[model samples]
Target: MIELAVIALRGVQYALISLTFGLPAFVLLNRPHLDERALQGLRAQVGWATGAMVVVVPIAILAQTALMAGSWSGALDPQALLVVVTGMGLGVALALRWVAALAEGLLFAFRLKGRGFWFPAVLLGLVSVVTLAWTGHGAATECVGKFIHQGSTAVHAAAAAFWIGALAAFLWLAFRPIEPGSEEEARAAAMLTGFAGSGTVAVAILVATGLVNTAFLVGPSRVLQLPQSLYGGLLILKLGLFVLMLALAALHRFQLAPQMAARSAHALTHLRRSLLVEFVCGGLILALVALLGTLSPPMAM
Candidate 1:
């Protein structure tokens, strides 16, 4: 029960942090040529997410400390706190998260626009996601293996944030009433088309990195026996959800995206629903990852 609570908290923290960086990063890269209203809406979305991360990061740190110490009281003990903060990889990752959270807070408070804000926010957000690699299975390895695993994991995580987080921002944009044949509608179509192209590339990266990470973590011999272990079972579930998300994404890219260019309401509605489903699947995958991080893989055992 305690572990479950920790996993749930970690899952939420991970998701929120991903969004905190992902949203701003998307705006920086895509810059979809949106109108004043759409641009303001996107900015507001990012601001709110960043502000929320400022709160969530501290709570996640406390929860992680307690989890590592084996009890809430122990988490507060100076010796336990010292060991966790100084000795553990997760501790370092948490510290990095704090730095990212502070940067995010500054971005939210000042609301800096133009290149000034974009450059710093993008850098901070990328660092936040990349630093998270230290908290996972990759950090447990040795020597050259450690570097390879961590690098791949970091790329995998960044790609996921780009795809899933952007989907969430796009869904929010879709909710606004877009009149048929208006400039706003055309911009929306263009943005959707642009995202679809980028999303395909991101998904390809995700698959390649996923394969690499899986090779490092689990060998071919353990493939058939995965369902017998808790970690492997959860991994299988995550993979299944990932496949479903890919199918939805394909539908969006091939069918819905083209129709959106024509300002088809049906396509827009279906795409919105698909994005929501994909976002939920991404959340579930993160939760499984949180649990998996706390367990020993079958191959390792």
Candidate 2:
């Protein structure tokens, strides 16, 4: 169905945009912690993500157009598509998102991070990520609470992207950490360990903002009835996956990271497995997020 296509495209859009934002932001925050090789590797990932955004953004726009027009054929209708792209607030947001994504691609192609282009690239990526809030409940709240809901959604998304995107970077690094048992390996392990503080901060922000967003969507009174509603059920599933990710993150912080720091046998091996599983969970979360956006909350009903 056209609806399913929109959700699927939106998931891919979110995943790509989040990586385009998250990877560079993560490296910038942990620049000193990562050496040139690790930085180079992650930067390559950023470029790839940005490039994909250039293609994916437009496709997502068209899909939204189809949803708005109420048919697949309507997605290609010039007039209807134009209205969605040029007349509506969704259009404005998508235009900005696409432009920001394109700017990132151009910057990366011209050599990001070295020629004074990295900052602009980061800003563009942030724009692309935050603009996504406009398409969902983030920007749909009524007066008096509109800004609060939007802010919560934006911060929730950014924080989630940062955490999830960094995990992807870590997975890439885990698979090819330059060399094993060398200084590179130790520094890499240290980088992973160093993420504890910032990662915790990101998680804390996610929880707080998530609570705020949930209250606005589901209302506290509807909490007990959540299981009986489609939106609520999906939210519970998303929360379950989130908790699993948290549990894995905790294990990495308290157990595996220490073991890696001490050079225990196969510590890195254990880490690679955990990172893969965690990142997979993150991907599933994004998919659920896409689906959730299409369903009305119990409060709305």
Candidate 3:
């Protein structure tokens, strides 16, 4: 049970790292502050996220092994090690892609000011996809089967990023307070709304593609029987979290967002409160994801 929890925590824990790293990245990208101080701050933010990924994954693997065994020695085989490394590597790549996207968005925002821009976001996105494919190929298949599985996993991963990743960003912005009655506040809100719309579209794609990938990864019969197994229980937990995220998203989109757009102080307050709640739930959901990753599949049981 402890091992399961640890496994589940791994992904969720690291997911937070990306969010922590990304929120500021978004801010830096969307509204470029040319000041040396701002640049230094952004660099530090990126560094912290990168540092965490470098330091934490190995510890997580060791901790997981130790949880399963009395000691970490000989607890994991080469294949398991490969899987862990690949998973973490993919995560790092994905995080970079998100950062890059934020950069690209910033570039577009810059274009409004007559600056010629390059495709940093598009380039980083492609890199992210490539890394994901490289990591997934090991699990999906070794040859042509590798490409098929890689493509499927990439689709699934992108969906996950759209929904889960974006949720993390929204939560961050929500929890952090914006100054009252300021021009920067309005600009911030506009920037946030643009991304919010992007997130919405991403979520839609994620859901549609996630369903397809789920079908391929786990047969319908196994999926149906998932509730009976440990994996199933964790997956159910993840699903519940996902549903909660959806509900919160709706509130943000239909309810609070309009109020905020109108600059209604009351609506802004409500949006902040709701965002805080969603952040907490998102954190919990991430922990469950980490546990789910560690469990054996329902079919395996």
Candidate 4:
């Protein structure tokens, strides 16, 4: 039961952190091409996501404390909190995440604009995701191996944030009441189309990094034991969900997107449904990831 709570908290933390960075970066990248109303919508999403992170991050930290100490009561212990905030790797990472979350709150509160504000805000968000590497397996290694693993994991996390977080953003756009054949609909379609190229690239990176991380966590010898182990089973489930997400993404790129671009009737409705399914799938993947983080891989044993 405690483990389940940890997994749930971790999943929410990952999702919210991903969105905190992903939404702002998406808006920054596409703001020029988006209509005024669309840009405003994106900004609103960013604010909401950032605000959410403010509340989620501290709770996640406390959950992590409990998980590490093996009891809920440990979460309130000053020494445990001090260790989490000051210890190497994960401890430092958690402290950094807290600082980043606070920074985001300040940005959201003031409605800071211009390059100065946005540039720093986006950087902080990216840092928050990258620092997550320290909380996982990457931090267990030493010297050069640690550096290589942490670097790859950071890239993997960033790419994932870009892909999955943008899906959430796109899902928001799909719900807007843009009439078929209208300028707003056309702009929305173009945005989705543009995302296809970047999304594909992100997926490719995710796949490659996934393979690398798998090699580190579950070597070739453990592959045969996958079905026999809980960690391996969950890993397989995650991969299956990832493949499903890929299929849905392909449909979006080749089928629904094209129809929407052509202003076909019912295209928007179909696309919206597909986006919602994809978002749900993404959430499942994150949940699996949270669970996996708590279990020992077959190879590690």
What TM-score should be assigned to candidate 2? 0.95
Clashing pairs in 3: 7-290, 8-290, 8-291, 9-290, 9-291
Best-to-worst order by TM-score is: 2, 4, 1, 3
RMSD of each: 1.8, 1.5, 6.8, 1.7
* Candidate of highest TM-score: 2
Off by over 4 Å in 1: none
Quick one: ranking by lDDT, best first?
Answer: 2, 4, 1, 3
**What stretches of model 3 exceed 4 Å from their correct place?**
1-9, 20-29, 32-44, 61-70, 73-146, 162-165, 175-177
lDDT of 2 by residue, 123-228 (tens): 7878987887888976678998988998888888899888888898888878883544666567667777789999999999999999999999999898999999
Q: What is the per-residue lDDT of model 3 for residues 1-301, given as tens digits with 9 covering 90 to 100? A: 5465455546644464444333333443454422344334443443454445445545555555455455556446655555444556544544454454455445445542212321243244344444444433235345665566567666655555435444554554444456554443454355455666656666776677656555645568787777777767777787787788778877777766656666766766776777777767767765665555455554335
Name the top lDDT candidate. 2
Per-residue lDDT over 123-211 for candidate 4, one digit per residue giving the tens place of the 0 to 100 score? 88898999879888888757887888888888999998888878887898888888887777777777877888788889999998998
**TM-score head-to-head 1 vs 2, winner:** 2
User: Would you estimate the TM-scores of all the predictions?
Assistant: 0.93, 0.95, 0.66, 0.94
Candidate 1 has an lDDT of 0.78
